[model samples]
Every structure is written in structure tokens, then in C-alpha cells.
Target: IDVGLQTKSNIGKQEAADRAVVNLETRYQIMNMVKDFVRNPANKNQMIPFDADSTSASASIKAYNELVAERIKLGSSAKDNNQALQALDTQIAAMHNNVVSGVENAMRAMRIQINQVNQMSANAGSAMSAIPTEEREARALYRQQGIQNTLYTFLLQKREENALVLAATTPKGKIVDHAYAQSHPIKPKPMMVLFLALVMGLLLPLLLLSVKKLLTTKFSTQDELAEIIQAPVIGEICHNRHKSQLVVKPGKTSSIVELFRLVRNNLQFLLTNDGDKVLLVTSSVSGEGKSFVSANLAASFALLDKKVALVGMDIRSPRLAEMLELQSLPGVTAYLAKPGMNLSDIVQSSAEVSGLDVFVAGAVPPNPSELLLSSRVNDFIDQLRAHYDMIVIDSAPIAMVSDTFSLAKFSDAVLFVTRANYTKRNLMNYLNTVMSRGQLKNVSVVVNDTNPNVSTGYGYGYGEE
Candidate 1:
């Protein structure tokens, strides 16, 4: 309502200014008409607006018409003086047409302006009507013509008052305005926009990382897997183990064979056909499936028709060579103590798997770590490698004794058996320190007793991604 009222007031001022313009135009036209009327010698001294009353012309025309009607009613012979009658009729017609036409035209023009005034009044809208304006030169001319001086004096005063008012109401020529006051700005509040964008840019990456951590159940990196195992992760096989096979055969599968193939692949890559051919297999504590991996890794290579010998290298506790009911023989400890002992004398063949061989850790060594670390043990490994295409050497765990580290340097690769939620972190830290010092160049870590439901656990499925 306030805005409406303000707009109305401004419009009122504008209308008054417009009306003043029209009044000035009309006054000019009126002066022109008066001048034209007086320029004729006959009308120069004789004509006065007060003398030439338009209302009087109209009344005379009406009265003459009434008399003409009465005369016609009195006689058809009223035209006895034809010349005078004709002259009277002609003068009446001219007076009547000119007076009525002039007054009607003026009134019609006035009505156009009156319609606008009426509309503005109905709305109580902003507008005003200014008094008719006169030219200064015209007013001076009127004074020179000896007309009443009071009228000109009054018009002059009114003109001067209005000029002062208009000057006051209009803005100063140099009034300050916003540079874009005439149009809208395109880069409004640009600094604020940039600040907001910068904030979001920093936050989005953190938001995505948080969301990823929340949704995934499986471990993605070696570090995470190591954390779960509570053991040092000696190494990693980047690709999935299950997808690859030792050799392709249709519609047949061996879970044991496949796992061993992975172990063998890692072994061959790390071990590089070097020391530790006569290996041992044992866990920190039992039920870790150390026997399973040792047994299968031997057969996985044997399936290629290669002579792969699986030796029960764990001397303190021995079960690998006995699982299949093989005859007991003086194996690793015997070979370690007597460098003269031959590899063929101790090895036995597996009836269950062809091309595969087994050997027991005949007698548990009193000092397995010291026995395995002997110079004679190094000779034993070199002797076995000459006869077999592959040799899977399973060793005693570092968690049980430091013996594994002694054997680690001699072996082509060290495959650490880690049970989920079994091995402690501090023990593994010691083992890791040993490996990092290049004690075992080809070392790999495998997770056992792993929960398959965990995305990063064993039995993880994969293709090319």
C-alpha cells in the first residue's frame, strides 16, 4: 500500500507537469487566434472577446429561428421584401454554423482531457490540473495594446511561482545514483558465491571417503588384512587365488589343488629355485590347516608330472608324513645332523596322489632351530633339489620358535600360515623385522581359518574386474 501511494503521488506530479505543457500549448493557440482576428483592419479596434460573446450569438440564432417560424405561420406573403429576407437568412445561417461548430469543437477537445481527469479522480490517483499558461511576449503585447494590466500581472506572478516549485521538486542535475540503477547487474554478490563453492570443494572428498568406509565389509589393502590376523603380513598375491588352476581340465575342480597352485606360484616367484627344498610344515598352534597347504602344494605341482616331494619338516611335532600312513624314517633332523645322509634313502612315495612323494620328520630334534640352521642342513637342501623338479618345504612357525627365521634365508620363499584371530601382532612384528632385514627375500603370507563372509577374506571371488 505504501508503494502504491508513493507511485500515485509521483504520477500526480507527472500529470500536473503534463497538464501544464498542454496549457502552454493551448495558450499559444489562443494567442494565435486572437492575433489573426485583430490583423484585419475592420476588427483591429472593434473586436473584444467581451463584445463578441458566443452565448449571445447562440441566443440570437435561436430567437430569429422562432420569429421566422411565427412569420411563416402568419403568411406565405411574408417574403414581400425578398432581398431583406434573403440577407437575414444568410446572416443567421453563417452565425449559427460558425458559433456552434467552434464551441462544439472546443468542448469535444475539453471532453478528451476531462475523461482522463475523471478516471484519475475515481482512483484517487496521482495527478493535478494546472491553470492555463500564457507566453510572456504575448502578455507584454497585450499590455502594449492597452488592455487591462491586472490580468497580465496576475499571470506573470503565477508563472514565476510555478517555475520555482518545478525547480525545487525536480532532482539536482548531478544527484548520485548507483552505476547500474538503469539496469540489473550480472555479477552481483560474486565474492559470496566463490566462498561457498570453495567450502563445498573441500568437503566433498571427505564425504565420499566416509561413505566408502561405512559400506565395505571386506578388507581392501594388506594393512587391513594384517590388522584382522593380528600378524605381520609378509607379502600379498594381488590377484585372486581360486580363479587360476595348475592345469586346465573340463568339469573338474580341486579346492586343495587350486590353493596349492597359488602357494607354488608364489613360492617359485620368490624362492627362485634356491635353498630350502626339504621343507617343514607346522603351525604356531594346531588346527591351522598347515598340513592341508603343504600336502596340496606338493600334489598341485606333481599333477604336471613333475616329481614334487612333500616332507614333514616340523621335527618337534610331526604328523605330515604319518597322515597317509607312511613308514617313519630319519628325515630332516637325520639329514641335518649327518651331512653324509642321502636324500633318496629318506623319501617315500604317495599312493593316493601320483608323481608326488612324502617324508616324515623321523625323530623330533632336541634343538630344531639350531639343527635347521646347521651348515649340514644347507647341504641337505642342495642335495634334494638335484633329484626333484619341485620341493615344497613347510617350516615351523616363527610364533613357536625363532627356527623359522633360521630356515627362511635358505628357502626360496617363506610361506607364513596365519590363522584369523589367532596370531598376535607383537609376535608377528618380530617376524616382520627378521624378513625386512632380507633374511627371507621371497616371503609370502596366507590367511587361514578365514571367514568367507568377510569380503576381504579367503575364497574371495574375482574376474578381470
Candidate 2:
């Protein structure tokens, strides 16, 4: 009964809303017709009359048309300044206002009816929805109660069956076989424990070594560096226990000095041509013994009485002067900044190496990269070529700065130095990238600071002091 009443109310309200919409459209059309006749009543169409409709707006238009016709007739008989004509104008304006007001009132009434119908329809819909909602909730509650009762009955049946089984009992029997100890014990097998311990003891160091090798990211041995770089390792200089910069002195016969001698001989084979004199020494980063290599390599050449000039081109970080215990000023920076300055004024002869000359980095410059790009650098290399048999430039690190690339064009060969266990594997990959890109030419690697014990194992102990 409740649902039926709500449905009837919804249907009635919906029909009312439809009627209100139709009335609104009719009123809107009538209002337009009245407004047109009032605005220009003289041009009224005879075929489609505004007064044909039964709406109040249609009656208003008919009255307005009569007033217009009356005004036209009175104007033909009266003067322009007559009082009757003025009164007629006033009447026409009042009637025009009345027609507009009637239209607004009709539209406003239609809108109110529409709003009321919509409210009633919404209320009826809500009422219609509640009946079904309550019925569904009641049905759901009944279904849930049935499910609970069924579940309880099933649980009680299972419990009763279990109780009956527990109350009843079967006949007891004696043990057919008894537990006994076996001849061989299951635990504490001395042979197996000892075997396992022996196996672990044998494999532990190997496992640890394998793990250490896998975790190590830097080059620790000569074979490791060579296998990864795939480049010629021209020399492997041993770790200098004395920590001297000039390990290749004329009279020194230690392992470090002999290694430098080997490097000097290898370079001789690599740079066979006389013009292969400009050797640029650099590394992936700083502290890889590049300065040490550069200074010592030049000194080794000097021992052969070859005129050698070791130039410090790492102007950003001048280490040659400090390593060689020479003054930093009036060297490369001074020579390049002042074109008129003589090369002799900046070049200083090493006291230790009689035939070798040292061109210090002078001072740290604000624009070292730009300075290396100058044409004077090439000219400096050319001048050194004319005077010396060998020119070794200790330039900036290739990875850390672009200054080395700028100076690389002036080199005949590049000696890349990487310290043992100090240079990362990724940097070696970067070197490969550099080589693959052909950014450098005639490149060779020199592994510095290798363990002396490891070197002796490589059969290079013949010259050890």
C-alpha cells in the first residue's frame, strides 16, 4: 500500500512538471509576439495575428494594437503639438509597460510552478525508494539469522559426534616391537664432523679470496690492470720504500730504480722515431704518481746523457716543483703569460740530474684550461723539441680536468699512470672510452706503486738491491 501511494504521487508530480514546461514555452512564445507588436505595431502581419492566442499576453498585444491604430487615426486629424496626441502617446507607453509586466508575471508564475513540481517529484521519488530499502533490509536480516542457525546446528552435531567417540573406547594391545639402540649412533659421528671441518677449512680461504677479488674495484696487481685495460702496460714501478721522488738516480740499484729503467727502455722502443720526443704523462686522477713518473722518467733519459726537459703543465695543481724541490715561479705560467720572456729565464736545471731541465708549473692559474688551449703551448712544445732529445709534460689528470685534452694534441705519445689499488676500475673503463673515441693517440699505461713482493713474483727481482 505504501509503495502504491508513492508511485501514484510520482506519476502525478511528473505529469504536472511536464504541463508546467509546456505552459512555460507557450507563455514565452506569447510574450515574444506581444513584445514585437508593441515595439512596432504599424508593421503587424495580418495573416499571423498576435491576438489569436487565449493567453493574457495575447490580449495585451490586441489592446496595444488598438491604441496604435487609434493614435495613427488621431494623428492624421490633429496637429503635431495637439494635447490629445500627447495623451495618446502616454497611453501607448503605459499599455506597452503593462504588456511587458504581464509577460514577466506569467514567466515568473511558470518558473514557480516548475520549482514546486520538481520538489514534489523529488520527494515522491525518495518516498518510493524507502519502501523497497526497508523490505530489502528485513529480508537480509532474516537470511542472516537462518545462516547463523544453520552454522550453529552444524557445529553442535560435529561436537556431539566427537563426544560419542571420546566416550567409547577400543581394546588395548601390547607392543609388537620394542625400541632398541642400533649399532651405529645417529649423532656425534666423529668422522663426518672432522670431514666437514676439514672441508670448510680447505675451502674457507679460497672462498674468502674469491669474495675479496669480486668486491675489489681497484687495480691491485699488474695482471689485473693489464687484463681489464687491454692496453700495453709499459712498466710496473714498485712501491718506493725510501719514498724518494727521484728513484731513478744514476747510482741507485733498488727495485724501484730498475723498474724506472725498464720503463725508459720500453719508451725507447715505443717512440722509435726521433720526432716522438714529446711524451705527455698523465693519469685518471691526482696522486697516481704521475709527477713522480714524469720527473723520474726525464731523469732516466738524462742518465743516458739525453737532453730532457720535464715540463709541469698541470698549472691548476703544481706538484712538479714540490716533488722536485724546485721553485714554482718563472716557469710555464711566467713563460706563457709574457711572450717576450726568454725560455732560459723559466727553465731551471735539476741539481740531481745533470743533463735534465725542470719547467715548473709556476703558479696556480685561474684559467688553466684556457691557458693550455693557447697557441703558445704548441710553440712551447716545438721549442722544446728543437733543444731537447725528450720532452715529458706532467699534465693535469684527464678525468678530473679538460686541460690534458687540450695539451694532448702536442704530445707524441701519452703515458697513462694508474696507481696499484688506488685507481678504480671504472676509470679504466673511462680510459677505454677515451681510446675508443680516438681522443688520444699512441697511449700506454704505467702501473705505479705495485707491491715489491708481487713484483718479485713476476720474475723482475734480477735488479733488486
Candidate 3:
């Protein structure tokens, strides 16, 4: 509605400008015509001497009257005598006729000249007379134009004033009073929004928790582990903030260390003969604490006075050497690449745990799968088995690489590590596949990085006893 009003105002102003332009043009034309008429040479003939012509004719008639009076006196004086009087009368008559003829001729010429002058005066007067009518018409037109200009100017001014008023004020609208909260908010209801957010903050976690419990198949507790896999969970390692891979120490009494002790003790039940058990530790994916569990489990076994060898079989990306702070060179890749390389030359002792030994992945090779499949690797494992009581091999993620499958063949058992809330449930399909194919033997899951909130259901706690 305001737009329509503004449009109308603008149109009116445009029409005003157009009318002003036309009025100015007409005024210019009228002024030009008046100026041309005033400057015209023919109109100057209105000053013609018609009165002077009449005065000249009157002077000639007076002179003729004086001559006639003179002739009449001569005739009157000679009329008493006989022949002389008659002759004098004839002479006077002749003179009188001559004077009369000259006068008449002069008067005729004056009349002709006066008539011509009068006609010229009349023509000039007629032209001049038309001027007043033209002037009146021009004035009337000018007055009309002025009036129109004034009207248009007034209209334009009013429009401008209206526009300014519209620009300065808000539009009128129907008003009604309604109930509102006291103390109108300046920036919005920040406190109210915060309270609502706090409520959602309290409820959102419970909602997500319920959804996770209903929709997910991933195990979060020991009961879930026992129910799904139908196997004993050797250990449940809590989440650790340690930067190193080997979390277990000989004298450390941390919950993680105690958990590893429990796992080492429970691992004995899974062994049939316990003659140098070769355990392969791997996960379906990386970052599930597979390497952490392998190194710590070895450290735990070493604390048990059993000679333990922790081998980094994941040549693709080795972290055990760096995690244990040992030299990565002269290890598995080098031992396997060189013909007749002794296992003792590659094996390095761990300084943290007295009985723990570590073999790094050594230099990265292009084909880790092929290297692990080589006959030399089997011989290397066998030699390590003869030397160490427990050979815990930290292999590559089974889901990502085939290195673990090759290394798993000579192992006595495989401990699959899965992190709670980290490892996906679909990995179970891959584990079941490997088990069904006979590629894995005596496979057990070690649920690593379990949340304490979830472990509470299984009565697991890390508090000091």
C-alpha cells in the first residue's frame, strides 16, 4: 500500500515537470512573436503625417480665397465704364479662372497624397490595433500558464512533503493491547533459553542412551559379551590416558595393570598344554587398542616370571617399538628379508619390564602381506617360541590387511580386541567369517577401553581396594 502511494506521488511529480516544460515553451513562443511584431519596420508607418497633409490643403484654399477677393475688387472698379470695364472684367475673370484652376489642381494632388497617407496610416493602425488583442491573448495565455505552473509546483511540493512525512514516520496500523511478560527483553529471553537448554542438556543424554541400547548390537558390558559371543571375556581394559602403548608395569598397581593381571591369569584356562603359547593379538580395525593390549599383555605375562616376547608383526604401520621406547631397526622386516638371520640378533629387551622382550617391525617394506607369508617368518616365530614362554604377536588389523591372517596360522590362540563405543558391531561378521573358515583358533575378545559407566553393570571398578 505504501508502495502504491509513492508511485502515484512520483507520477504526479513527473506530470508537473512535463507541464512546466510545455508552459515554458509556450511562453517562449509568445514572447518571440511579440518581439518580432514590435521589431517589424512596417508597423513604424503608424506615424504617417495625415494631419500635415490636411494643413497643406487648408493653406492652398486660403491663398485661392485671397486671389479671388483681389480679382473681385478689380472687376467692381471697371464695371461703371463701357468697353474698358468689360475688358477689365474679362481679364479678372481669366485671372480668377486661372487661380481657381491652380487651387483645384493643388487641392486634388493634396487629396490624392492625403488618401495615400491615410491608407498607409490605416494599414499601420490596423497592424498596431491587432497588437493589443495579441498582447491580451498572450497575457491571458501567460497568466493561464503561470497558474498552471503554480498549481503544478504546489502539487510537486505537496508530494515532496508527503514523501518526507512518509519517510520520517511509521505507517498507521490497528493497535491492540495484549498480555505480555513484565520487563520486556532487550536482547531476547536469554535466561529462558538457557533454562530450556539445560533441561534438554539433562534429557538428551538419556534419550541417546535409550536409543543406543535399543538400536545397537555392539557389546558395552561383560554380560553382553558373554551373551553374544558365548565365550568367556578374558579381560575388560578400561580407557587409559597414557601416551605409551605398554601400560602395564611390574610394580604399578593401576586398575589397567590389575586388569591385565586378571587377563593373564584367565588366559591360562584357555591353554591346553601351556608349552610356549603363541598368542596373536589383533582387531577388526585400527585404533581399537589392539597394539596396546598386546604390549601390556606381554608386560603382564613378563611380570609373572614367564619369559615374554612382544613382536610387532604389523609391518604396515609399526608402533610397538616407539611405544616401548626401543630401537625399531634390526627387527622383523630385517630378520625376514635377510637369509639365515638369527632371531636373537633382532630381539631387543624392554627396560621397563625386566622379563619383557620386544621385536619391532623394523624398516617398512612394500609388501608386508607377502613378507608375513614367507617361510622365514614361520621359522622366526618358531625360534621365538622356543626362546620365550609366551610369544604375543601384535598383528595388523584383520579388516584392513591380510598380514594377520598369515601370522595367525602358527598361533595357539588369537585375542581379538574391541573398544566399547569405538569398534563397530559389523566387525562381528568379519570375526565370524574368519572363525567359520578355520582361519582363527581359540579366538577370544578382549573388550578394551570400556567406559566405567557401562562396566558398572558387570561390577567392574578401578577404585583402590
RMSD of each candidate? 25.7, 32.1, 34.0
Q: List, residue by residue over 129-234, the lDDT tens digit for candidate 2.
A: 6446776467447544654555456446646753543333222444699999989999998999999999999999999999998899997777888888957988
Model 2 has a clash total of 0
Local accuracy of candidate 1 as per-residue lDDT tens digits, 76-150: 444546765566556544644554455445545545665665455435332222222353345336433433343
Q: After superposing candidate 1, which stretches have Cα over 4 Å from the reference?
A: 1-223, 226-256, 271-287, 338-340, 455-465
Q: Give the count of colliding residue pairs in each prediction.
A: 8, 0, 0
Question: Tens digit of lDDT per residue, candidate 3, span 75-136?
Answer: 44445566755664455445434433443444455455545544554443443443446754
Q: Roughly what TM-score does model 1 have, to 2 decimal places?
A: 0.43
Candidate 3's displacement at residue 259, Å, is: 0.5
Best candidate according to TM-score: 2
Give the C-alpha miss distance for residue 349 in model 1, angstroms. Answer: 0.7
Which model scores highest in lDDT?
2
Candidate with better lDDT, 1 vs 3: 3
Ranking by TM-score: 2, 3, 1
**lDDT, residue 2, model 3:** 71
Candidate lDDT scores, in order, read 0.55, 0.77, 0.69
